[model samples]
Structure formats: structure tokens, C-alpha cells
Target: MPCWYYDKKELRETPSILDGISFETERRYRKEGARFIMECGTKMGLGHNTMATGVVYFHRFYMFHSFRSFPRYVTACCCLFFAGKVEETPKKCRDIIKTARGILNDNYFYSFGEDPKEEVMTLERILLQTIKFDLQVEHPYTFLLKYAKCFKGDQQKLQKMVQMAWNFVNDSLSTVVCLQWEPEIIAVALIHLASKLSKFTVQDWEGRQPQHQRWWDMFVSDVTMEILEDICHQVLDLYQSTQKETHQSSSPPQKPPSRAESPTAVKSTNSTVIMLSSVQQQQPPPVSGNGNLQEVNNIQSIKSLAGGVPVLSSGDAPSLPQGPTPPGQSHGYHLYHAPPPPPPPVVPNVPYPTSAWGVQQTLPPPPMPPSLPPGPSGFYSTGGRQQQQRY
Candidate 1:
């Protein structure tokens, strides 16, 4: 019942982005990290789910950590190494590191540090803690295939559309869409996007009816064109992004110095650069000041909050009345209720968790009221088993 979904604002202003790294730069870092995970997973013969889960962990880990502090590629390796075990496609840490080394250039590979296996193992621990050990991540891939099955279309065309949607789902790992929406929602939106791009119209579906003319309605009732458009645009942005060069476009242009001032400016700039370099080298990445998941550290507390199972509060305790009662009324609060045989309290109508855990979280039936066991005087007086009062 732990909610992992966050808003676009949180995604835009991640810890790395707040630590002097631009949002675009952080995003590119995520993409490159995801790419690294995918390529490593594939080369290691891991399944799509394993790689996707690893990429998801990579994204979520950076939510609390920073790209400036941690090498994204190294973290990517750790995620894949961790994700393999979670997804049951377990791979050795050395194998993963070796695969990463083979794929990365010498400069990039140096990020692994000496004893790369140990580095990845250490990061694996941090990655586990960073993601709050919410290891079971859902991707758009499963939902895409499931929904594609429901579509009433030509077999080959449907195959192509589903394949395209599947590819879209894979591409989406590079984006923050997983952090923004549920897998089902992402699947629906991508399928809609794919259908349009592939020119495949959904004339009917498994649950064809007057009210259910649309396909998404069957899976997700509240899906809209705008929401779908936003999702599609996020995924499409990757295509546009891929075409663009990965240059430092966001850097500020240096001002030219005059001949008379050039030497002084050069010395001043050199000194300033040295000072800044030293400071940057020593300074750790900045932590984000605010977000919905500011501190998603405690697993139990998050689950309890999600479950709306609050700890006992003063408001729930029975308080004594402050003022005297009128002459016509009794001072006892229970006098008017005839509590000799009180009716059971009505359970409040709280919402069930709207996630996979919902079905598994069914409440147990209320226990039957205990009958009065005969005392020495042939009557019982208190609640609980054997007159043992429960807190």
C-alpha cells in the first residue's frame, strides 16, 4: 500500500536538480542510466521485467539521492544487480560489473572505482534503502499486452500495434512517467498513442457496448484525451530529445576581457575557478528541501498512513463533560442512550487502498459479542477473554 507515485513538480525538482544540476541535465542522466541498465541487462540475458524494475529503482533512488554525489552509471549497475534478485532473474554482481565495463568507455568505466564489485554491492545497499525497499515495481509492459488482448482488431495489425506499444513502454523507462502515473494508466495512454501512430482504429473491444465504445474505458474509466495527450507527449519528448545533441547548452557564455584588463581578469578568473573547484570537490550534493516524499524512510509508517490506520489520538478518547446538565437531563453521558445493552459501533466508511494490495487487504469479519459467563453470583461483568480487559 506504499504509494510511489509523485507529481511532475517533484520529478522536475529532484535532489540532483536542486544540487546545482539542471532539470534537463538530470533527465538526461536518467536516460543514460536507463540505457546503461537496459544494455547491461540484455547482455547478461536478463528479462525485460528485470531491466525495467532496475531502471525504475535507478529513477526512484535519485529522488532522495543526487546525480552529483553518486555516479548514475554505477547506480544503474547496482540497480540491475539488485533488481535481478527481486525479479528472480538473478545475476552475479561481478557479471553485471563486467557487462558494464565492456559497455562503458574507460573514462565512464572508471566511475566503478577499484573493486567494482564491492562498489556495486555498497550501492546496492543504498539503492535498497533509497527506494524504501519497495522492490515490486510495476511497468507499462504487462498492462499493454493485457489491454491489447482485449482490443477487437485484425490479428496482424493488432500485433504490430501491441508491439509498438510495447516498445513505447520500454522507451518510457527513460522518462519519469513511472514516477508520475500508475502502470495501468501509462499502459492505456501509450496504447492510445501507439494506435494513433500506427493508424490502428479501435472500432470495438472485448467489452463492446454503447456506453463502452472506447477501449480505455474498460480498463480505466476516468482516462481522458488530455491525460493521454500529456503521457504521449512525455514519451514523444524522448524522440525529440534523442535527435538533439547532448551538448552543454545550458552553460553561461563567458564575457570577453579588454586588453588592459585581460591579465587581471585572467588571474581573478583562475583564482575564482580554483576556489570554486575546491569547494565543489569538497561539497556534497544538496538535499531537496520539499516534496511529497521528503522522507519516505519508514516502511511501516508509510504503510499505516496509506492504510489510514492511525495511532490512538486524544480525540478518540472519551472526555468528561465540562458543564453541569440541565435539571431535566441526567448528568451521565450514557443516560439517554439506554446503554444496558448497547448496539455495536458503526464502522466508518473508509476507502480501500486503490492499488494491487487492495484485494489482499480485505478486513476480517467483526467478532461476535461474548456471552456473560456465570460468575460466583451467576453473572459476568466485564469484556474480553476470561475477564481479561484488552487495551
Candidate 2:
């Protein structure tokens, strides 16, 4: 079998067409990707670890495969299913297919019903060959634990950062960063950014100067600060956009003109009078009082009223920033538009289960390797046991 890593560089650096897509389009793709992962794990009744494992496997597959030819959604589903098997969690084909149908458009998702037994078997062979059968994936949970314990303040912010870091790794799979870095380094970068985002003050804020202390110097050497900076920039971009979009229109009014008289007060008073007539119609109604009504109208300008809470409704779903461009300018795919008239506010009644949106699952104890005493630095023989080995 041909090695999957033959063209790994191209996979990481090549821009997927979806990179320049609009926000809504990008959102749909994410939804598809998320759904694909969910279905793969749910099929075998596996927990979140298996789902996360699936994401890693999917990324590995795409590293060698062409995104243009293979449908990403389908590839995602295949990778997750394969990961479940490798992790010793077997799922039924029917259950996986059925669940996908329930949520996806019936017409478009019909392909799920087709038998994947043969296709999965083929993919499994390809996956094993590509990875040389290596299945061990390093997760950031351990690093997160270490960081959280060491940094006592901003526990909630640190926790959120940990989660964000985990997601950063997931997204980075589709980017160039994964090509050069090991899993441990990637984890470190993500956790570092998460800490930055939380803005948590370190325990020895003043004491741990980089050049002054050997301990601080040693800690920095274990991770790549450069990559951490890049990841931090990306994560911060997403966060800023999410914050900019405040959900409610009725947050609060600006400080009421002021306690004493000021220009703002005059402007606010004028704004009120102008809004009343403007909203009423283009032509003002005939006034009962000749001078008073005209005098009030003359003082007010409608521009201030026009500025109040301008609607930010987007035709497409919002997404994370992509490529080298500043995230403020970059918009993800916007595949579809909303109805001509704004849709009525929706109230979804179905309560979401914690597991559904991928809250971390309780992990099973990892198997420990038997102690083999000491050995040489280079590869050792299997002693004729004919067992598989992985790096």
C-alpha cells in the first residue's frame, strides 16, 4: 500500500475552496461536519472520547485525500465510524444511517441508507495502511489539568480556555499548523492561548520574569510560543466577533444626558421630538398650536434616533475567520439566505441533552503497558512475537 503521508505538505498548505466561503456557507459545512461526527459515535453508543478520536482520524484521512473529489461530510462520517472500530466501539450501520436521516434534509441525506460495509472495510484498510496502523492520539486534557492546577486564579476562564484550546486543535487539523507540530506541542499551544484569552493572572505574576528565573525559562522551552501566538490570534478573532454580536437590543441606555445640563441633553431632547414626527410620516401632521409645535420640530435632528440599535441581521450564518487575512475582514461561507421577510422568532422546545453537544465524556481508565525494565535508544526486536508496532 502507498504511504498516506506522501503528499502531507500539500494537504496542510493547500486552501480548501471553502476557505473563502461566506459565513452562512461556512456554518452549514460546520453543521455537516458536526453531524457526521455525532452520527459515527452515536451509532455504537460510544462516548465523547470516541467522537474526538474520530475527528483526529478524519483529519488524518483528509491529509492524504482530496477534499475536492471526496465529499467532506461523507469523509467525516467514514473517519468517525472507522475510529469507533479502532477504539473497540462497534456501531450498527442502520442506526447511524437512520439518525442522520432524522436531522438532515430527507432528499439530500439519502446516501446514508446505502450499505457502507464494503466501503467501510475498504476505508479501514486504507486508514490502517495510511497510519501504519498507529492509533494512539495524545489529548490535551492532561495538559489542561496541569495548567488549571498550577494557575489557581480565573478557574472558570481557564476551564473555558481549555475547552477552546481543544476546539482550536480540532480546527487546526484543516490548517497548516498540524503538519509541523507534534500532538503534545499542539496541546501546549492551545492551552497557552486559552490562558491568554482568559487573561488569568499567573500565581507569580511579577516573580516569573522570563530571563530572570530558570524555572520560568524551563517551562517556556517545553512548548512552542510562536505557534501559541498564532493560535491565540485565531481564537481571539472568533471571540471578538461573538462578543460584538450582543443578543438583545435592550441592553441599557447610554448615561441619561447627564445630571446637569449639557449639549448631549439638548441633543437627546431634540432626538425624541424628531423621532415622533419621522416615525409618524414624511409630512408632519397639521399642528394645533402654531409656534410651539414648529419650535420643537426645528430644534430636533432625527440622525441620533436613526443611530439607535441598527439591526445586524445577516442573510447567512456567521462563521470563524479563515486564511492570513485579519479575522475582522474574513467571512466564512454563506451558502443560503433567510426568507425575504424576517422569519418569526422561533422557540425550540426540545431540551438539549448534555451529551448531544459534546460535553466531555467520562473517560475509561487507559490501559497501562507492562514494565520491560531498560532498553537501548533505537528500535528493539519483537522477539518473534509478530505483533504490530507504531511510532
Candidate 3:
């Protein structure tokens, strides 16, 4: 007969079978979902065992179904709901749904709809059938306490170590160690880690062998010091990874400038003013004797000055001046020069006269000077004439 147990090795080899989600994504969702289970259980006043069992149910369910196939939060809710019933601390589906909604609200990324009770009920049935109603889950909490009592040294120190180890076991649920290791092994490993962290040494209980050998010999032969070390490393790795993730997530984000307080708008306005000043500097002095062309040129110059200044919107940056540096300074600050304003709007001085051919004859507008090439400011003309053309 074929065994019903899943082969973890096979699953690892064919991970792509789980839609397009990577193993890292699956791990992240599992960690978050486990945390949600704990939060929900706490809000509902359920015991620690109930929460632990629920997390186990979640882990087991995901072994067969991808997180992509079913939503993690809904499945997490179903696990807690079912675990409560199996542990004889039955909670109503409605109550679980309410707690789930509250927990999800704490994270802006997730939200619950008007009703999730029906969905929770459906998932609960699927969860129960998945594990074939084998609701008995052996947690490491009880075993941790049992092993902690075996330490023969200072009572106060023992209490602290045990507490630390208990917390470690709780954090270890977020890792795959719980699924891979037995409860006794996990419990012993946690206590060993706690003792090491507390700097507490184990005392020989019996006068059998040396102090070092007695510690391992105290427990069943199945629990070795090597296994404990491996488990400890796994737990520590989990802590380091979680700390890195937390630091990254808690970092401040860069915010863009708002419309009311935009620097670009201020710069653009300043640029336009600068461009107008530069244009004024380039104007030729008024001619002593007046010729029609010179008068026209003077009029054109005045018209160019009168032309509308390029209205720089919030997106435009202020242009820098390209004028020669002062006597003492070798280099001047590089600034963008604004584009030339458009030619002044033309208005007809008089109505067109009709020719003998009965066609209206009109005078053409003066030809505009060729615009200068764009300079460093990305604007046409090194002079402020470009600012006038932009309008």
C-alpha cells in the first residue's frame, strides 16, 4: 500500500507547480498568516494551544494547496476556526470573522467585505477534510517547560531561561522547524538556546558521567546535542531574517513635493524674472537719428519686450544665467535660460484695400529673426529673447 504522507523533497523539486509565486512569497505569506492566527486567537480569548494548533493546520493545508489558489487570510481564519472546535474551545464562525476583520484592518493592504462567514465555513470544511479530522497537534510549549525544570541550577535563573525559551518556541512557529522537527526535539533545543543566551550552565543531576555527557544523557537517546544546535541555528536565523525585514519595512519613504509647496514653480517664476532682465540688457541704445527701419526696429524691440513672459508651470525648472562672470569670479553658477517668448500677437492696423482685379490686397507681417540655438538651459537663445517666444 502507498503511504499517504507527502514527500517534501518532491515538492521542493517541483516548486514552479505552485502557479508563478516563488517559495519566498509563500514563506512571507505563511509568516504573516501565522501572525494573524495568533492575533485572532488572542482577540477571541482563546488559549495558546488553540492558536498553535491553528497555525499547524494552516501550514499543513498549504502543503497541498498553493497560497495562490486560496487567499491566505481566509484560510488562516478557517484554520483558527477549525482548531478551536477540535481543541474543545469552539468559537462561532461569526466571532472568528469579526476578529479576522479587525486584524486585517490593522494592515492597509487587506480588507474584509460585508460578509465572510460563509466563506470561512466553506474553508473550514475543506480544512477538516484535508487533514482527515486529525486535529491532535503536539506543541513544544509543554515539552519546553518540562525540560526547563530539569535544569538544577539557580531557581531565578531557571525561571528566566524557561521564559525566554517559551518565547523562542512561539517565534519558531513562523519557521519550518516546527514542521520538520518533533516537539521534544524542538522543546529541548529551545531550552538549550535559552540557557546559552542566559549564560546558564547545566548542573549534573546524577553522579554518573562527566558534566558535559550528563546533559545529553539526561534526555532520551533520540535527542542529541547536534540536533539541538541545528534547531538553535534555525531559530536564530529566523530572528535575523525577521529583523532585516522589519528594518526595511520601517524605513521612511521618499515623498514628492505637493502642488502648494512645489519648488519647481518657485524656480520657474524666478527664471522668468531673470530672463526678462537679461533681455533688457541686450537691447541696443536708442538711435540718435530716426530712419523708418530703425524706428521699426525700435518698435520691434519694444514689442518683443512687451510680449508675454513664458508662464512656467510647476513642472519647469528655473533656468540659470549664462552672462559673463564678474571681474573677480572665474566661473558663474550654471542656470537654465528660459525659452524666447512667442512673437507679439499681431493686430491689423487697417482693413485690406480691394485691387482692380477685385481681390483684397494685404501687407504681410514683418519676418521674425531666426531664433538662436538652444543653450545649456534647454531653452532657445542664450539671451532672454527665448523667454518672450515661449509665450
How well does candidate 3 score on lDDT at residue 312?
17
Over 203-242, each residue of candidate 2 has an lDDT whose tens digit, in order, gives: 4532355563422343446444665676545433432322
lDDT of 3 by residue, 1-391 (tens): 2123344564453333456666555665666678678767877889989999999888878777876567777888889888888899999887787665544432211223224676778777788878776778889998776666566778877776676667667767766676677787788788776666555677644434553464645654657677788787776665445434433333442554332221221111110011222223443222111111123232123222101111212232223335654322322122122343479456454536753223232433345667766555666654445543352
Name the top TM-score candidate.
1
All candidates' TM-scores? 0.63, 0.48, 0.59
Model 1 scores worst on lDDT over the 10 consecutive residues at 265-274
TM-score of 1: 0.63
What is candidate 3's TM-score against the reference? 0.59
What lDDT score belongs to each candidate, Candidate 1 first? 0.63, 0.43, 0.58
lDDT of 2: 0.43
